[model samples]
Target: MRPTLFLICPVLLFLGLSYLLPFLGIVQLSFTDPQPGLAQYRHVLSDPLTLAVIWRTLRLCIIVTVVSVGCAYIITLLWVRGTPVIRLLTELCIMIPFWISVLSRAFGWLSLLSNRGLINTWLKDAGLIDASIQMTRNEFAVVVGMAHYLIPFAVFPLATAMRNVDERVLTAADGMGASRLRIFWQIFLPMTGNGIIGATLLVFVFSIGFYVTPALLGGGQSVLLAELIYLWIFQMPQWGMAAALSVVMMIAVGGILVALMRRNAETAK
Candidate 1:
């Protein structure tokens, strides 16, 4: 025990200096900056624009979570059930995105989805429409970009759950004349419930904090909470408000994680 404590001391010390201290500083700034009171928190919670941004963030997060999880489920299903070559291709598709930077990925989506971008240009050449569709700088574009980024996050958890399913049970179900769709709906889906929930929550949490993709794709119209936080800190120079918003977001995320932990513990029991 003494040796274990000694071994972990450096890690704990590193975390305290790097993470915990900075977070505490932010919390302190939120409460004490400008004055030692809850004025910043109250203003953030009560302000109309802030409230709108909060709602937009939550709404977009839900949409992105659903879209990402749905696409990831299909991809994970293919990855788990496919042949070696197919699995290899799927893995490449998933991991290639990770190698690319987030900024690059957002720009790539912009190139494809912008008004005069490849998709619109191709559609025009094909004479599908006379005018280019307004795709970029909108909620749709933000959702597409966010979903693309989050799909990989959703896939790994689902793949783990899918891989753990007993193949013998599936074979037995097939032998008993259960249809593929029925078996998947009843057995496979239920077995992967935890993965689905985990992926949804993870994606939602990530979407809430997304800044760049939304900033680029949203064109200032679809501003979310993170963007609002940025605006407060840099543009408006309201450090206290920014810190308060940060604290709020931190609390929300921490609450979610705690709930997830409790749920996992219940499942373990």
Candidate 2:
């Protein structure tokens, strides 16, 4: 035990210096910079624009979480039940995005969704429409890019839960003449509920911090909390406000995690 403590203490000390110290600095900035007090927090909560941005961030978080998790559930089901080749292909599809940088993926979406891009060009040549549809630089485009980026995050947790399910129970249900839909609805879905919750939490938390995709695709029209924070720090040069927003976001995320943990504990009981 003494040796284990010695080993763990170094790692903990390293984290304290590298991560915790910096975080504490940010928290300090929120209160100390530009004449202290709760003024920064007050402004963040009271300002209409900040409130709107917060709401937009939350709304987009929910949209992206639902879209990513729903699609990931389908992919996870295939991965769990499919043949070796199909599983291999599914894995390749899921992992390919991880290899690409976030900036590249966002730009790729821009090229595909832009007016003169492939989809519009094809549509134009095919005489599908007279004018290009406004696809890029919108909420829809942001959601698409975010969901594409986050699907893999949703997939792994769901696959883990699905793989843990008892196969014999499914076989017994099938042998008992249960319809596919009924068995899935009654057994598989309930069994994977924990995974769904986990994926939702993971994706939603990630979605809140998204910057590049929303910045590029939103075109300033659909500004999220992260973008707003950036504006406060660099563009507006309001470091105090930015720090306050960061602290608020951290507290909100922490609160959500605590609430979910309590609920999960209650459910287990």
Candidate 3:
């Protein structure tokens, strides 16, 4: 073989052996465990608890994806439009969150969202509310932490797309008497469609697989599919069930990606 093939061979071999083999094993186990049939998949799909968790997971992922993309778009706009100081500060704010450990970020939010924590205490002392609100161990807290963690993933792709948008086009439109919102709707928004799609997919996929942040924040009442998978594997030692859920997650993610790619391709043509 050639020199490039020789260089790539070890990495390919490692991936096949380490990653592919284990995934194939999981797939096999999902099918063959407890007598060869589709019982595991049927259980996952038909069980009320499993179905509820799936719905909750999808809902949370959708909310996180939308919120993260919206916030990232605004941040990108600010980064692009602001002065040197504003730009520097925005960059720092966006980058700093990614620098911290995600677990630390989750814990930080846990503290801030707790009843006696900063916000509630200040609110009560200020008489903003009659009592301390339920903040931590809830859906609200999960979304907040997940959004914070995923914002950087959303920002980079959006910023890249927004940067490629021609300011000269917007300036020309302004000279022609177009309003800012009109300019964005007619010109900028259409231009950044690909980036927006990419960022949405990235955030959604990451949110679905998320474990620590949601587990810490979502409480017992709001168990996500990831948590359900964890419960099966570690708590109950139901390997077949865990493997089945994993397969479903993989299939869902793969289907989304395939659809996105096909849509992008058709749009390109």
Q: Pick the candidate with the highest TM-score.
A: 2
Residues 72-147 of candidate 2: C-alpha lDDT, one tens digit per residue: 9999988889999999999999989899999999999999999998999999999998899999878999999999
The local distance difference test score of each candidate is: 0.92, 0.93, 0.89
Candidate 1 accuracy as lDDT: 0.92
Q: Write the per-residue lDDT of candidate 1 for residues 118-210, one digit (tens) a residue.
A: 999999999999999999888999999999999999999899999999889899999999999999999999888788888988898888899
Q: Estimate each model's TM-score.
A: 0.94, 0.96, 0.93
How high is the lDDT of residue 126 in model 3?
A: 93
> C-alpha displacement of 100 in model 3, angstroms?
1.2
Give the per-residue lDDT of model 3 (tens digit) for 241-261: 889999999999889889987
**Structural RMSD, model 2:** 1.4
Candidate achieving the largest lDDT: 2
If ranked by TM-score, best first, what sequence of candidates would result? 2, 1, 3
lDDT comparison, 1 vs 3, better candidate:
1
Better of 2 and 3 by lDDT: 2
TM-score of 3: 0.93
